[model samples]
Structure formats: C-alpha cells, structure tokens
Target: MSAPCDNQTGGPERPSFVTDDELERALRDAFARRVATPRPLAADPAGLAVRRARRVGRRRTLTGLALAGVATALVTTGVAQLGAPAGRDGTPIVVLGDPRGSSPSPLPAESTAAAPAAGPVRPELDLIVGSWLYTNGGERWELTGVSTVERAQRVPDRGGWLLTSAVTAAGRTLWWVPPNGRPPQVLLAGADAIAVAADGRRVAWRDGGEVFAAGAVAGQLLATTRAAAPAGAVPVGFAGDTVLIRQPGRGGFRVWHSPTEDRLGTVNRDVLNVYGVRPDGLVVGQVSAGTPRRPCLALLDPARELAPVRTGCDPELATDGRGDVSADGRWLLVNGARNAALLVDLDALGSGGSGQSAGPALTGVVTWTRAGAALHVDAAGALVRVRPEEVTAGEQPFSSPVDGVAPGDRPVVVADSRP
Candidate 1:
C-alpha cells in the first residue's frame, strides 16, 4: 500500500500539539542539530538516525497507542481497507489526521470482524470517521462523512467526543446528542445531546429530555430514562448511573443525581448541564441556577458535588454524547472549543473578549489527562501527541501517540505508548 510522505526528523520522536509553524520550527531545529553534530557521528548520522528512527517509528506504528488527532498515520495501515463499496466510487475518505500521505492500496470495504447481520460490516466506526446515523424510527440510515469544518454539538453530562447529528442510521432516524448519537436504542428528543468516547462503547446522550446510554453493542438498552416527571426541568446526559438533570427553582439549573434511569432530581438549582465527565468523578458543566442564561461550567468530582471543579465558561453538551464542546477557552478555566470551532479563525478569541491565540488555537492543547499521562488533540479531535511525564525505560504495554483518537472512543486493550 502507498504510505504517507513524512520526511520530518529529529525533535521528539513524535510531534506534540504544536502549531504548524512550531512543528516546522521544531523540524528545523532537528535539522540544525543534525548539521551541528560532528560528521554524522561514526559514519552517516542521517543514515544512523533513520535506523534509530525506524526502530522507534516502527514501534509507534505497530502499537497505535495515541488518541485520534490528525490522519497522518491512519492512512498507513487502513488505506488498503478503504476501497469503494459496490455502488460508491473510491473517494479517498479523509480521516482524523492530515491527508498529506500518499495514496494507499485500497482495501475491500469490509470489516475484519463478522459483518453485522443488519448491514455492512464496518471494521469499526472510527469516532473521527463518519458515523452511522439512525432515525427515530430506525428505518433509514445515512452517512454524514465526518469533516473538520462541520459544527459539533456538545453536552457536559458525557465524557467523550460529542458527535451530534440529525442523520439517520440503519432504518431508523434518530436525534443523538453526542459521542455515538445514533445508536439503535437511543432517541435524543428535544435539543440533540450526545457524546461518543474514544473507545466507542461508552455512548452518552439525552433521551426524551433525560440522559440515557448504550454500549457499542448493536442493540442493547445500556441505560434509559424519561425526560422529567411532574413537569420538572428536563434532564440532560448521564454520569455513569447518575443523571444530570436541570432543576426547578427561581432561575434554576442544577445537576440532580438520580438512579441511572431516574428522570427527575431533587431541586439543587445550582448546576447547569453535565458538560463533561470522566470515570474519576471529574464532571464539568455550566452553573446556571442562580445565574440563569449566563451559565458557567463547573467541574464536579461527582463523589463530592458541592465542590466540583468550576470553570468560568459554559461547556456545550454535544448531540453525540462525546464531551465535544466549544470549551470557551476565553476564560482561565477553558475546556475546548466545539469541534467546529476549529473552522473559526484561531485568533478570533484574542481580538474579541474570547482570548488571544497564536496560530491555530487547537494546535497547542491537550484535551484529556489521566494519572501522569496526557494526550494532545488537534482541531479535528485527533490525538497528535502523548506526553507521559516519565517514559518507562523498557517496552511496556504502550500504544502509539498519533493523531485521530477522538475522546470517548476508549481503546479496549491497555493503552501503551513509547514514552
């Protein structure tokens, strides 16, 4: 298969979330460093570097540990697997990473796994790739090929990529919030609210006004809920078994925790929507109860609601349930901009009250942090860099720190990376 043409050398084995100019500068520095070193070390330093690089590069290539950021490397392996179906032409599908790679030997558009009994067996929906949209009735299906320019829906309740769309999947037309909005079982009525994770299995969205969820399983009621009972304020997404509901009081907006299936909540009237969440009770969202429309997000440690991590901006709850949002970085405690926010001038924030940024704002940021490990994502929700404060000396179970691992789509295996 034809491979991507990346001639960059030196610097960190992998590129971090640096601006293109920064990357270019880094590459230049690497080149200068190579030039500065005495006569290519022993024989030819360039050749030696390639040998060393190939070793580490091959390791990164094999592991595929990084989150989805850009399409730089995604084209290497799966290009062969991207041939046109019976009817469609072989239009090169632009994945999460950059499309500068060489044309790949297309593969039969069939999944290595058994084809779903209902439809074509996709290897798996790359959260960064197009999604399988379903209708409320589940009768028709459509593919809104994913792109970076499109606007993204966001919701705080979910902890992943916010994949919001009005498309249909299978035979059903569904309105999803984020993450994987078009699952067979979910129906995010009212304003769309959904979020898909980097792993794909953990889908979160609003259903009938209340939060609900389903695993990547084709047809399973992961979690279900009614909007709100007694005409209480509607609920949004789900934080594990707890639902993020809007409370009712004077100008109320709160996160009233209820059983996974509970549609109602005790009136707290302090929280906004569950904008973003993580397995570790780190929940963030807007606080609107007292503030009303001027809502600000609060990051809650779910275990302790009163003292959640509060930010100065509002996080949108995406239709796909992925914690994809316009993390109004204008404020000190910024999350991330909406997936589509990338389309905006990276400097728009700076000139305006938003925030001043150099180059593409998305170019230099990390979206998620766990333990001591950090993964950086670009405008397209691809994981471009992995910064592990301490790289394990030997080969541990590490994954490649590349582009295109959108948040929420959790990799099933242990994520090992070349530190």
Candidate 2:
C-alpha cells in the first residue's frame, strides 16, 4: 500500500505538506534577504533632511522681520499722535506729556511705561502780568513793572491800573495807569476812598460824604454821576451797578443804586462787618453773635435783604475784615484765629458742610488770586501759594521766597481785583 492509502484508493492521497517548523524557517530566510538588499533612495536622505531644516529656518527669520516692521510702524504712529503742533513763530508748543530737555530712558522688557513728567508750574495771567503789586523795603513794586507808587490796584479786566499817590493835606490823589504803557493820567485830585466794579468797567469814589460813580475807560473817567451817600457812609465796593457803602460804627452795609441815587436796602444788622463781596453780588460777612454764638463766616444774598444764604461757624474763625471770594464765587478765604486762614467752599457750605483751615499759621495777610489760589505772605516773607483744593487742616501750602524781597520784609498784596 502506498503509505497505507490515506484516502480510499488515493495513492498517497496527495503530496505531503511542509511541517510548521520548516514554514517558520522559510519566512525568516525571506525576511533576512529583503533586509540585506539596500532599497533605492531618491536623494541622500541625511542631506535632504538638513536642506529642509534650512528652508524652515529661513521662513521663520523672514516672519520675524515682518513682525518687527509692523511693530516699528505702530510705534512711529503713536509718537506722531503724541506730538503737538508748532506755534506761529516755529517754537514748539509746550504740551503736557512732551519730554523736557533730554529723551526718556527705555522701559524694561517686563515693566510698564512710567507716567509723563509733570510740566513746570506757571502762575496765571493775573499773577504773571502787571496785576500783582506789592510793597517791599518801603518801596512799591508791580510784579512785572518797575517800582512806582505806594499803593496800586489792578483793573479786573486788565484795562489799566489804579494808582494812589501824592497824599496831600486834602486827600489821596488817584491816578490811572493806562494798560498801553502810556503815562498815568490823574483820575481824581482828592479822593477819600476808591472802589472799582467787578468788571473793571465802572469806578466809584468818595469825596467826603459825596459818592461819585463813573465809567472807567482807557484810563479815563466818563459819564460821571454823583449822589449824596447816607450819613457816615463810606464807599467799599460795587455789586454790579449798585454801590456798597458801609456805615462806620454800624454793624451792617447799605446798597445804593448809583444811577437812580435810590437807597436800595440795608444788609442785616446781625452781620458784624462786610468783609468782601462776590462777583455775583453775594456779600461775605462775619456774624460774631448769633443763636450758635460762635464766630462764623456768612454768605449773604443782597437781593434777599442780605439774608444768610450759607453760614459756616467755628470758634477759631476770627474775621478782621480781611477776606475774599473766588471770582467764580466758589471759594471764600477768611482770616482766622491764631494767625491762620480758613478756606470755605461755598458749594459745600450751601449744601450744609463745614469749612477747613488752610495753609500754615501765617502771620501775614492771605489774599485770593483771580485764578482761585490763595496768596499768603508768611512771616519769613515767603510768598506762599495755597491751592484751595489742596488745603486741609494742619497742612502747609507751597511757599517760595519771592525774588527781590528780603527775608523779613512783609509784602502787601493788592486786593479786590483778585476776586
């Protein structure tokens, strides 16, 4: 039998299949031959990889340069926007953020840019120009002009200056210094007292008991009108067209209509003295005796028969008839007890708030500027600038020794026009 005939009469059935071990050996040999024979490469594989890397680096470098250009353009635009236009004379206008003298240093990589340096502090037009007049060393001096008179008053509108000189046995001679730099002209020969309007357009003076009102124009008086004032009345100031006359030995003031010569009304007798008048015709006064009994600063409305519009009382408030309101009628600075000054916010007072003590304990007088800064001449003759907004109790204002003023010399500032 051919291998015992696996199937019925199959003659060894079929060719014998390979064993499992033999098949595994054949597969391993095939794999070994395929690995031994090297495959064909399109190019040097290592060189191709290096070239690809170089191309990617070039692309990254180009992208970095493009981003830097965009950043530079944005910075240039920002600088142009911050710059201000030049003046007509080709001088650059001084703006708030412009660098002074030298360029600023660059900021650190992680730090934010610092705030711009503050510009130099400058006085307002009333303080800068010819308005500031003071006396020093027995000689008078205009802040911008030469020493000329013993006392000077600036016109509120900068029309000119009212100067007092030649005090004779008769009375004080009033002179008008024209704003155009012309020689001063004589305004009145013998004026006992003088008061200028808030607008500097009208002027009133007293020759004995007779009060006169005239239009102040170009350093000359026009349209003069005269009216006999109440007995013992002295011209103090002008509230619009009305003339404010204080009666000596009396505790109140009287309002006189200059044009009509009609005695309008009287301020309340409770107001001990009229310190000053605001631009809006409100009178600032002191009430020494009242229901509260404490000395207080009272803002009186003349239209309402001098009724108290607002009152701020403090035991330390001592008014020696030296006080003023800001031109905008917002601030009131009154002389206080112990040589200090009190700053009252009219808005706050109207809303029922208290006053604040301002500046150092100055031995000298405190006056307000048209720009609302309190000007105080300290004991050391330092011209101190007190900002009302910055003033707090027991705080000192900025003090600077004025040039040409000695350390011990006290300078008296011109009044009324500064309100």
lDDT of 1 by residue, 303-399 (tens): 4543545444323322222222222321121233443211111213223333211122333222332233333344443433222222222222122
TM-score of candidate 1 on Cα atoms, chains taken together: 0.34
Residue 108 lDDT, candidate 1, scale 0-100: 32
Per-residue C-alpha lDDT of model 2 across residues 313-346, encoded as one tens digit per residue: 6435665666667777788776677677667777
Candidate 2, after superposition: displacement of residue 169 in Å? 5.5
Model 1 local distance difference test score = 0.35
Error of 1 at 205 (Å): 4.3
Q: All candidates' lDDT scores? A: 0.35, 0.57
Look at candidate 2 and tell me the lDDT of residue 182: 39
Question: What's model 2's overall lDDT?
Answer: 0.57
> Count of backbone clashes for each model?
114, 0
- Taking all chains together, each candidate's TM-score versus the true structure is 0.34, 0.58
Q: Which predicted model would earn the best TM-score?
A: 2
